[model samples]
Target: MNSDTRTAPLACAPRTPALMVQGTCSNAGKSILAAAFCRIFLQDGLRVAPFKAQNMALNSCVTPDGLEMGRAQAVQAAACRLDPDVRMNPVLLKPCSDVGSQVIVMGRPVGVMRVRQYVDYKPQARDAAFATYDSLAAEHDVMVIEGAGSPAEINLKAHDIVNMAMARHAGARVLLVGDIDRGGVFAALVGTMELLEGWERDHVAGYLLNKFRGDASLLDPALDFMQQRTGRPVLGVVPYLRDLGLPEEDSVTFKEGLPGLRDGVAAEGGSEEPGTGPGSLPDILLDIVLVDLPHISNFTDVDALRGEPDVRLRVARTPADLPAPDGRMPDAVILPGSKNTTGDLRTLRASGMADALARLASDPDGPVVAGICAGLQMLGLCVADPLGLEGGGSEQGLGLLPVRTELAAEKTLRRTTGVHPRSGLPVAGYEIRHGITVAAEGGEGGGTGPGRGGAAFPFLLREDGGPLGWGTHGGRVWGTSLHGVFDADGFRRHFLDGLRTRRGLAPLGRVVASYSLDPALDRLADAVRAAVDMDAIYDMLHLRPGRV
Candidate 1:
């Protein structure tokens, strides 16, 4: 079999070129490298897509086809301007509650498998990985794949589906990435090769040194030494850009939330990031408010708003703390996600914020009050949290959206893609929620509807083979168990701009929604590809014809 082989793709026919990012170990920038390369390839005018034959990261996403995958590739897919689907991330291993993993097969949870059970299922996992690779390879012009952890995890190497094993199986050209800033960078690379058998080492064509700081020439001596010892080329060094403002895929990168406002520190003008969006503010100077409850998740939703030139975002610790808003109430109020619904609801009610939220929703100004995930559920009338039921009691929602929600035995975890039927527009997102919210009759029970105490509707409805009035969802002022709804920059720009306009502020007129990030990505990818010795990697791995 020619190296670019995939079990699923062979079942079809493929025509795309493939590349892989191999890491010296975890946090070696493998996912970033893949993302950058996809951008680079797209900049080259190719219909590029990103893929990771297999990945194991705590940061995960659900695919459009309803499969669960790592969030890293999903972020890269956003950069590549492609829909995040199962084919983009074929194999997903999510660490479920604890020792158990909710194994996702082809965009659906197969079952909970323990580590030992997963070990026994390695071959199946790999076969599934190849199947995913094939499915994606058949569609695009270029596919950038990513590897997980060090290629040399000895204990886990036997059953490894990432790194050289998958690369060898996929016949992908390998560009190994090494973190130079990490001490023992040389040993990390050389020792990794020494630890690997001849075939394993062969797939790495070159090595890219990432996160390098200071002068490049000063490190030339060490670079030359690595080249001489391992005979692999040191491609280029990537200088770190502070606050690159990209959405991070894993918790390791969550620290960006701290430096400014996330830690609750006020910036030069009161608070830099307490609520302002990512990068710079939007062009409009509308003051927006967010209900800063206790259990915040999906904080990334407002990250891109920081890039605008004229918007100010603030978090409301209490109703009394709500911004005076240029002598008027806020143009909009956003209810972000929460990890604990019942607990947060209680906190809201006890803190008097719930009453404040209800008053705002009822305000005749008709300001848009947006809620996401648990935030969306909280906008409803009642949250039937079984956790509270079993542990003592339950809490009532603010009744702003007119809906009722309850926790279910099983969680809905997977990628949700395609047009948001309610909006009839392309909205890419995924769902990971413990609670299943069903729109209830809002008549006398204080449920969600225009006439009820609530101001907005709960969810969007689907009009397909599903029912009409109440098929899959309900109305706007909606919430799905989905995260990464803002992954699509266009949708994000539109939504934020709309909210800003509603607040009586001007929009960032025709700002570029699709940022051509490939230039930045290519500078990164070429550096990675240039560092590792391709000829030697292919030779060591026995990936050349007749070796296997």
Candidate 2:
């Protein structure tokens, strides 16, 4: 659970059986497939764990022990009913820009490096990754491995430790997954097999066609051709699933133009449409706008809010995306976390969204403006990166909150639980950031004590009575450093109810019970199990039918 250091003793258990899911390209549903296998193995009564030697993503989760790792691995761990372990993802690359990324080894940030620098550091990264994989493999009966991007990237193959190389290291049976939904599935699968070296191709067991829609049977001819061409079986054709209620692996989901919005209409499941199911929808729909920053990170923080049946969540990318002064204003505005606070702040300003946000916050009846992590920093008066931690320089914030932030060398990663001061509701989440924020010189509510009347106050009080965030305008304008705050159902409901009260609508009593991923995981497992040949999967893993 602690930061991975070389001095730590390595486990010497025998190599465990493993199955690696490699994709034809990024977002080919490799992560979801690995997660389903994890759940399936667990259901069959085997000790299972998920691993990705190296991950390049801005979406991350802080483990209970205060370590950080890719969020996809964390989701897979949940599928196995296990807490996330850093060993599951030994190397994490969080991109701050197109050319550079913050290198995280063993749950701790080492430094930021450009592509060339990272390539030179790969030897060390490879060693750490192998060591961690060994440690995790020793603890589990079987390992479900996930490969990053594609294995056929000729430019990256030499330095690759996340795809075929990792599969070879683990002696894993590789299932090349292709997204049939993207078209050219046949070409993508055949081309990948052709590009891989003979030695690398030896580990290939078969293929899994993912994200298919309509008749899966229609793919039979292509499936047969793939098998005949590559001498590999097509194990499954998984149907495309919508609104699966699972966290996405990365920002590629935004490419389709704002999640939950297709052709300017809300998708099914938790759509903005009125709910006929019991207590599903509130009397009035609360429109929530989330500012889509250029380097938006942890966008999943708003997933819980987006799932509410009565809350309509929209992504606002420019000033024009915001509600006009004369039009029906949104019920709230949220600024999500960012990988590069100063950089995104500049983007907001250049696009005039910063000014728009400030105007909204200043309005007496404007929708509640809330911020999380970097968003909280952007709400302050200034964001300074004196050490060049975030490409250096400082930027003027939106000035909605009376605070200032300074980027430090060391990053903070921890799980937190607190009480919402206004509602006295319990809240739990985690913090992952490098900026240290404090009250401005003449800022109101500078003290940690409770607020007098309804003036500016701390957003949350830690279990030990320490304050966590700042709030003003009677809780209408607030920001917190904690991500996933809305996941706390009671607190989320209370906050939403407040919005209803402000709009003169009766509060909708608790509609649904608290949310849990167990049901969702089970549903996913069921669908995948029905689609894929579990018996063949077991044979690939050398696992028995009943147990390990």
Candidate closest to the true structure, highest lDDT: 2
- Writing each residue's lDDT as its tens digit, candidate 2 over 1-548 gives 11121111112222798999999999999998999999988888899999999999889999989999999999999999999899999999999999999999999999989999999999999999999998899888899999999999999999999998898788888899999988998889889988887767778788999988898877788877776778788999899987777888898986455566653335675444344553434335677888897788998888787678667777788878776233577889999999999999889889988878877777788889999999988887788999988768888887777777999988999999999987788989899999998877657432221112133468887889876788877778888999889999998888888888888877776744355677878989999999998888888777874566
lDDT for model 2, please. 0.83
* lDDT (10s digit) by residue, model 1, range 1-548: 11221112122222445677887888787787778767655655666688776665445666666556666777788767776777777667655334655566666656667889988887887888887787777776656778888888899888888777777666666677788777677778878877876666555566677887887679888878776777566665666544444556554544333222443222333322234564433323555666775545565666555444444556777877564433456666777776567777778888887777667666656556677778777876677756542133556777665456787656676545555554454555556676777666632236333326433332433323221111111232445554655556666666667765666655655554353344445555455445434445344333332222
Clashes of 1: 38
Work out candidate 2's RMSD over C-alphas.
6.5
Best candidate (score: TM-score): 2
RMSD after CA superposition, every candidate: 8.4, 6.5
**Clashes per candidate, residues 3 or more apart or on different chains:** 38, 0
Residue 262 displacement (Å), model 2:
2.2
How many angstroms is residue 534 displaced in model 2 relative to the true structure, after the best TM-score fit?
1.1
Q: TM-score, each model?
A: 0.66, 0.93
Q: What is the lDDT of residue 474 in candidate 1?
A: 23
